[model samples]
Target: MVDLFGHAGPAQVLERAARSGRLPHAWMLAGPPGIGKATLGYRFGRWLLAGGAEGGLPAGSAPLHLDPGHPTFRRILAGAHADLRALRPNTGEGGVKRVIRVEDSRDAIRFLAMTPAEGGWRFVLVDGAELMRPEAANALLKTLEEPPPRAVLVLTTAAPDRLLPTIRSRVRRLDLAPLAPADLDPLLMRLLPSLSTTERATLGRIAEGSAGQAVALAEGEGLAMQALVDQVLADLAGRRHWHPVAEAVAAKRDGSGFATFMALLRGALSAAVRQAARGQGAAPWLEGRALAEWSTLWDRLGQLAAETDVLSLDRKQAVLTALLWLTPPRR
Candidate 1:
């Protein structure tokens, strides 16, 4: 079983199931994206396969250890484990497909019908279960209604309410919330050893309680990006013309720092707007009409961000151009 870092609720549920031998046939692990629900599911599957006594195995047990090379682990990692199946969107030659079709769900049903190859529980993990189309969801509901013995189905999603009510009712629902700062700090440090305490703290605040997002930001080229955003905002407040701003953004568009820079620019403008709304007072340099104007600019920048898909590189330059307007006039 993987040692899921934080998610005490699901951890307790797993411990209880192991102790009582009353594990549910299917469980829905629902929470915000990037939380550790998938890790928890993998850990539970490992425990089931090992036939080891559940609940508090010695801290050093091999089963608890994550060995990607182990035969069973390898199969799971390769997504070829006869006893396990995962339902996720297919992103093949035709670009990203948004829905998990009924065919895939039927395959899961077929896989579950057979006895386990290892005489253990068969585990199925559906990532983003809410992506299931109506027919696909109905197919899954049949299995949930009369799940096989010694079979475990784990469905994970950031939005569970989108799933069918029938499917939701048949399975145990475990909610995983964002990790606490104390719990996430060590992980962040490990992931970004070069980050100063101050930088890490800033990232944590921006992460908004999501440890996964914080780690991702730390790994990203955020520092350089943040610098670019700071420069742009300063220029806007200084009333610098847009032409020079556009040139600067265009120059860096292809660099390693571009994505991070764009994200930071968006976040900074958002923070400024929030501050303005709360009457927290703008930066010392921003006062009177300048502050009010920038506040409105910030609102428009946010709208642009929502309307534009950040993944589209073509749209990125335009987004940055819009952000340039947020800068104050130069003396």
Candidate 2:
């Protein structure tokens, strides 16, 4: 299981259901990206597979705690478990696919239908459930309506609203809130011990309570991307040249760096918009701009990112278009 931190309330809720012998057959774990919804799902699976009996922690152990050395934990981690199955977007030659196909969802449903190999429980975890294609979601919805006995299906998603309404209606939804900075601190320390204090602090602020994102930012071009965003915002304020920033983002062949750039850009714009709306903390560039201008730019950036992914549009052009939003014609 992923190294889980915080989310004690959700953990206890799962434990209580197991203890009461009323554990729901279908569960929806909803939260923002990288906030440990999937981690909690995996931990719950580990608890079921390891504890064998539910309801109470052993003696003084924490809620939903299981020994890492336990055979079940090892099996699940190694993908050697017979009764445990998971579905996520499959990777293709280009990269991770954008959506989970219908066939994959069918396979998970079939796995759940089978009798537990260990004569205990069968588990299916659909990580990023919102990525399921329409056909895939419909197939899952059918099974959710009449889930198999002694089988548990867990769906974790950052965007629950993207899921089919029928599918959402069938499962017990549990929303996980973003972790606090305090909660994220220890996680960062453990996962990124090599990071300097300043680097970790920057990640914590930009990550917005996502431990996974913080770790990713620490390991990848996140800091550089962040610096670029800051430079772009400052340049916008001064009406200075932004071609260098756009060119830098466009130079990355794999598009990962560009994606990071967009995420940081969106985050920064979102903060600025909120501040502008509240009539406080508005950045100098935002002082004279109408709120709609900032909000529209933010929305346009998101649309460009999505269009680039689905339509395979030119990323360089996308970056140029986004920068043009801030470089309106001088009166």
Candidate 3:
């Protein structure tokens, strides 16, 4: 019901597994962020609660399409469903916690032990399951090892590799690929009607197939940061002053703006390297550079960015240093 796009194959696989009546007690919906892993998990859970058999519907109805007006859908949306439990990381005094705590993980196990109030099936959806702490992962793994009857647990994660190997082995894994740029157009057009066609296309390129990220970028300073990256690249070979741009980027105290700028910077470098490799005309800044030099700069900047985050380095200084590296050596 969340306007899912793509992944029909995965949906059908779920339906087949359900119809076979040997549905796994736990399912891992793995994919990049914002591509609807959580959405699909919820939909499948809703379908199962609504008597999963496709036989009751008219011809060719999607197995997972529950009517929005239905009580099950309404309850899940309102978080009042008696037979369903959904978990995400909790916020603390500092901010949102990076990991799901062990207490919440144990609570989910308790929720599974109870008989379904609906007298049918109970479901637990763990969004961002990879964020579970080590103890939390171990606690959940116990339930996965010996799941309760008529219960299902769905775990959605961007990085499936981070899950404990024992936990990963217990769940049926479904990996969702990112949507194509063209597929993102409808979402961008609908969510960001004021943006021009060209702007949308650029977002499609920079968003890298995550519609959620595309919308978030449009809502934030992403476009402006991308423009700054373009400006820096266009003037990299010249004597133009760049301190103003670095200062402006550093002044973005929210951190997301600076992060977006760095990401766009890396993307630009990647584009230039790809163009050079393909024997196409590279970006203007790459005019006189060796492919290896450009590649090395890209790798170096990437490491610097990671270190800046880890070590809390001065962002302004980092930007200045990156710009200096972008400059070609004077012959």
Candidate 3 — which residues are off by over 4 angstroms?
59-63, 92-96, 271-292, 306-314
TM-scores of the models, in the given order? 0.71, 0.83, 0.89
Residues 1-331 of candidate 3: C-alpha lDDT, one tens digit per residue? 3666777788899878987888889999998888778888988887888777534433246657778787887888888889999989776447956778889999999999899998888899999999998899999887898899999999999999999999999999999988787667887888889999999988878877877888888988888899898888878865466888888788877567668888889988888789778988777678768888888888899898889878888988998888989888888
- Relative to the true structure, candidate 2 has a C-alpha RMSD (angstroms) of 3.5
As for candidate 2, its clashing pairs are 19-55
Worst 10 residues of 1 by lDDT: 55-64
In model 3, what are the clashing residue pairs, if there are any?
A: none
Top-scoring candidate (TM-score): 3
lDDT of 1 by residue, 189-305 (tens): 776788888887777666755667777766665554565666665655453544454455455444434445556666675676668778986754355345567657666766565
lDDT of 3 at 70: 79
Clash totals, every prediction: 12, 1, 0
